[model samples]
Target: MGTWQLVLVGLVMLLGLLGVLVPGVPGPLLVWAGILWWSMSEKTTPAWGVLIGATALLLVNHVVKWLLPARRLKGVGVTRQTVLWAGASAIVGFFVVPLIGAVLGFIAGIYGAERVRLGGHGEAWAATRTIMRAVGTSVLVELVACLLVLGAWMGAVIHG
Candidate 1:
């Protein structure tokens, strides 16, 4: 890739990393797309290897991000409906309040769902904490994976 292309790819990857934090941004997908673009453009062994590795990492991330939280939630007796509610609420909150509102809305949504289902504040709060923990862990995993992918891209760039 040309120097300008590499720079552009880097900028796009950076945006992807930030997308990991921002709701509805499709962060992992963006990162993958950038990497794929660069790799195809370069058509080198290192680039291909990095692309494959990143593909695996992202695949694992997607699976685990859903599974771990779901398992934990199930273990704690959290219903799928509650999770759905939280996600729906988070979407609404994102539109209603923007940035921070999504987080706030998610918490509120989960709590509201749990409260309605369980009919107890304490139980709802406990479930909310567990959900938050799971979310945090998923985000952390995604962030790390994205960073690793970025590193791989940079390494290919440098070594290419």
Candidate 2:
């Protein structure tokens, strides 16, 4: 591929990483699309194996995130409702205040709900801290997921 094409791919990869920091962007999907666009441009297309692996790398990050957390949460005694509320708040927050609001909103909503359910501000704050930790880890996991997509794209270039 031309140097310009590689530059564009690099830009897409950067955007994918940025999307990880800000909520609501489909980072992995965008990364995959960018890589696929490049792969299709080459005369000798990327191997089917490499393409499949890249797709899996793009796909499995989300799947593992969803499955692993729910299982671990069950082991640790956090309810599904807590997770649901956190997600809902995150979504609502995006509309309400945009950008950083979603992250804060999720944490605040979880804490608020826990306080109402627990009936003590102190206990509620503690539960909120726990939820905050979980959300933070999830964000980190997402960062790693985007990195994996970048790796897969590079691998396609090297091995194709």
Candidate 3:
């Protein structure tokens, strides 16, 4: 890739990273698109190989993000209804309050669900903390995976 193309790819990767934190933005898809953009422009074996590897890693990240937290929640007695409420709240929050609202709404939703189900603020807060931690862990995993992909792309740009 040319200098300008590399710069563009870097910018895309940055946006991909931001998308991980922002609701409604497809972070992994954006990262994969960045890889595709770079590989298509470079057309080198190493670039293509990196692209394939990143794709595989991203796929695994997606599966793990969903399964790990879900398993943890289920193991801790969190019901699917709570998760659904949180998801629905996130959607509403995305429209009502913008970028940060989704996260806030998700937290509130989980807390609310637990409060209703368990009938105490202490227990509800505990559940909220658990859910938040799981979510944070999932986001961290995605961020790390994205950073690795960005690093690989930078390496390819430098060494291709």
Candidate 4:
């Protein structure tokens, strides 16, 4: 039913929003799902080329982001234990506190881990800053992509 399609679109939207909060679960991926579903329905099939191009853009963004400083993640000068503890703490923070806590969790994780493992608050903080900057860059890139996806969806709707 047409309404069911809309429901999937809404699910896509929810996933996209949550994806913003949590890494790994991607927002654009969900948006693409909505796009695909809507297109399959007798909806104005937004050009496949546009969809493919947008996906290509996301791929490029991913590659470029990889080139950037790895933030809050494992890497040189960062031990596996450090990364693992950081993640574990963040997960706990999510349930223990809530929205803001989850965010603070990462920062605290690094600080706590390094302070214990590396025994240097300064070094730990430097890593934290680097990670935050990378995270910021990632969010900006995703925001732009999300805007494009929305525009494409809207175009399909209006033109159809």
Candidate 5:
């Protein structure tokens, strides 16, 4: 792929990463499509390998997401803003403390948002738990899967 094409692919992947946070967005599919586009353009062994791995990984991600409990944010009263905060925090955490930090940051972000909204630690914690049980696992799984795919693509691009 040319430099511009690579940059465009990277931009698409980044958008897909952000899409994972927003409800109703086909984040995984977008990420996979970006990989496919890059692989087709590059036509190298590593590029093809990355595409295959990303496809399998994202397919598993979809299955796992389906198996998880459906999101019930309305029942739990978790707002979209809270989810956005959690996602933004997760991104920062991923870079700040690596893999584990993402989880910690997500949980903290939820707690912080709930604390601000509910005005008490106890209530916020309860709401946080409810929110997590309702939707956190699904989002976390999808985010991690996309991150893995993005990381693999970056590695291939760098090494190829």
Candidate 6:
């Protein structure tokens, strides 16, 4: 793929990552499609490998998400702003502290957002816990899977 095509692929993947936080956005599908596009255009061994890995990973993500409890954010009163904060924090955390940072950042982001919204440490923590139980795991799983795919694509692009 040309540089511009690669950049576009990256943008698609970025949108996919954002889609994970947005309801009914088909995040993983976008990520997978970006990989498919790149692989089809590049036709290189590494591109093919990344595409296969992304496919398998995203398939597993779907299965894992299905096994998890259904999202109850509406009942729990979790807001989209909170999710967006958590997602942005996760991205920063991924770069700041590598793989584990994403989870830590997500939790912290929830807590911080809740703290600001509820205006009490105890209430915020409680809300954070409730929100996590309601929908955090599902979002986290999808985000991590997408991030892994993005990382793999980046590796292939840089080293292929």
Error of 3 at 134 (Å): 0.6
Q: Candidate 4: TM-score?
A: 0.73
Candidate maximizing TM-score: 3
- Every model's TM-score: 0.93, 0.79, 0.95, 0.73, 0.63, 0.63
Which of candidates 1 and 3 is the stronger one according to TM-score?
3
User: Ten-residue segment with the worst summed lDDT in candidate 3?
Assistant: 151-160
Q: What tens-digit string does per-residue lDDT give for candidate 6 at 1-160? A: 6889889999998999998986547999999999999999999888889988899999999988866634566666778898889888877887898657877888899899988888999988998888677566888989999999999998888887
lDDT ranking of the models: 1, 3, 5, 6, 2, 4
Q: How well does candidate 1 match the true structure in TM-score terms?
A: 0.93
| RMSD (CA, Å), each prediction | 1.3, 2.7, 1.1, 3.5, 8.3, 8.9
For model 4, state the Cα shift of residue 73 in Å.
7.2
lDDT of 3 at 77: 94
Name the better of 4 and 5 by lDDT: 5
Error of 5 at 29 (Å): 0.8
lDDT of 2 by residue, 47-134 (tens): 3454566688757778776676566556546666777787898888878986787987788778767777788999888777766666
TM-score of the candidate numbered 3? Answer: 0.95
Q: What is the TM-score (0 to 1) of candidate 2? A: 0.79
Give the deviation of candidate 6 from the true structure as CA RMSD.
Answer: 8.9
In order, candidate lDDTs are: 0.90, 0.73, 0.89, 0.68, 0.87, 0.85
Cα lDDT tens digits for candidate 5, 15-56 = 999889865468999899999999999898899999999999
Sorted on TM-score, highest at the top, how do the candidates line up?
Answer: 3, 1, 2, 4, 5, 6
lDDT of 3 by residue, 1-160 (tens): 5778788888888999999988778998999999999888878899899999999999999999898788878877999899999999988987899668898889989999999999999999999999888889889999999989988888877775
